[model samples]
Target: MEPFQWKQAAKGPSLFYLSSWMEGEALTAGFTGRDGGFSKAPWQSLNMGLHVNDDSKTVVRNRIAVTEALGWPFESWTCAEQVHGARVHIVSASERGRGRDVREDAILDADALITNEPGTLLASLYADCVPLYFYDPVHRAVGLAHAGWKGTVAQIARHTVEAMTAQYGSHPSELLAAIGPSIEDCCYEVDGPVISKVEPLLKELREGGASMAPNALIADANGRARINLKEINRQIMIKAGILPTCIELSQMCTGCRTDLFFSHRMEQGKTGRMASWIGMGRGEPFS
Candidate 1:
């Protein structure tokens, strides 16, 4: 069964909830779609990114709409600048809602955001790049990571897990992880540079006795390869000590399903962004 289940509302942001996580206590986690907001062409209707040339006010409205739809307060919306690095910023109550509306106020130069602070919604924008989610029910900590090809090469998955372990005493064995919508290998082809960086990671996984998908990296005759980023991240999580059974991988591909998602590659770089959000709240019901 698909882990991120889409829920359409009559008048709100269309979203895919990480359904299994919703069954837990006061935790809201999911990805937004390209619908039910107020942005114009190129950004279309529901662009959630402020830095992508979308009107900042319109982007804020869309974001506020998502928060309302999730039954989360707009005041709790928080984010990072997402520099595609491995740095994980531990979000505190003081930093709550930092990047909710403006880029300058967001967590700087960090691709991963983790928090044990309830009511702080950690959001990271995405078009095709993978969204990595971490939840440690034992410690009541949650995290969101933006894993572009660069961040993946830097092992952001491992970094987030290690940060949660250090900051919140979270055991990776108790961490439930999820890989959200992104371009799949079917729609994501890469050149020598990307392949060079990814191959060593594959080698490391193989040497570490990890069972990776055989087609995780498929090569072509032109020194190019199709990479399954989600699977690669899944293997990275396993290498970082998260159990395979505890991880949920979304099957939706942004490139393949542009009708339901925004694809920077497919759209030739003129596109909006969706958001991946995760946070725990105080006695809040799952909306």
Candidate 2:
């Protein structure tokens, strides 16, 4: 399928929008570009990271607009103070609005969140980490995962699938997945240490009609190997039982699309966060 369209939101400064195509229920999933909120430059408008050192008040206001646009209550959204780990929190009705509360221990160090509860928004913050959205139309359940290179090699996407199967009785054949906007291979370069972790999973691509000879490694200008993260994680999902036709990856890269996204690498550790969030609709899809 073609990539989702990006549009400007007239309600604020320069907000952009994203939508997914799993061809089922009224579920919404997308990432916020660096716009439409109350934060200052570098943050620009909608900077959603609570720990990004942006003014807390601005972050709160931006989040409110996000939920409002999704037709969800501002208080019902859920998120984590992600620390680039593989922890996944299974959200429930009892834990509704937990991320919006003042508890310091609100699902500590989690990098992923999944829930079947309609109207509950599950998401994680990122500038370059891949955001993976999961939906089982047959089961009417949805999940979200944050995959950095570390998480991808750890098979977090596979773990998410297994979690859905065990927790919500979701079947792999019935699931639809979308890997949201993040750093693409064009802008993501790595060293031997990182390549060692990704090599096993990348064997498929090495054989898939690329310019390289089989069993040969390709390095960059600086002589460091680069890996295609989207391809690697796609393998993880397929290995975990998702059909090849059920997956989508963003064509846009945050590190490359500087005007539209916040790239932590491009910004040199001083940038705002873009959020990838998913929520079940209010019985029916909303415009």
Clashes of each: 0, 3
Per-model root-mean-square deviation over C-alphas? 1.0, 3.3
Model 2, 1-287: lDDT tens digits are 44445655587533333444523447777777886778897787778887877887788788888777666787677887777667777888887776663326356777778888877888678888888888877777888888889998777888889989998899998899988788876788888788877776566544653333332335767758756666677767877788888887677888898788889888888889888877776534524
Any idea what lDDT model 1 has? 0.93
lDDT of 2: 0.75
lDDT of 1 by residue, 63-123 (tens): 9999988887899999999888999999999999999988999989999999999889999
Model 1 misplacement above 4 A? 282-287
Q: List clashing residue pairs in candidate 2.
A: 35-46, 37-45, 37-46
The candidate that achieves the highest lDDT relative to the unseen native structure: 1
Q: Model 1, clash count?
A: 0
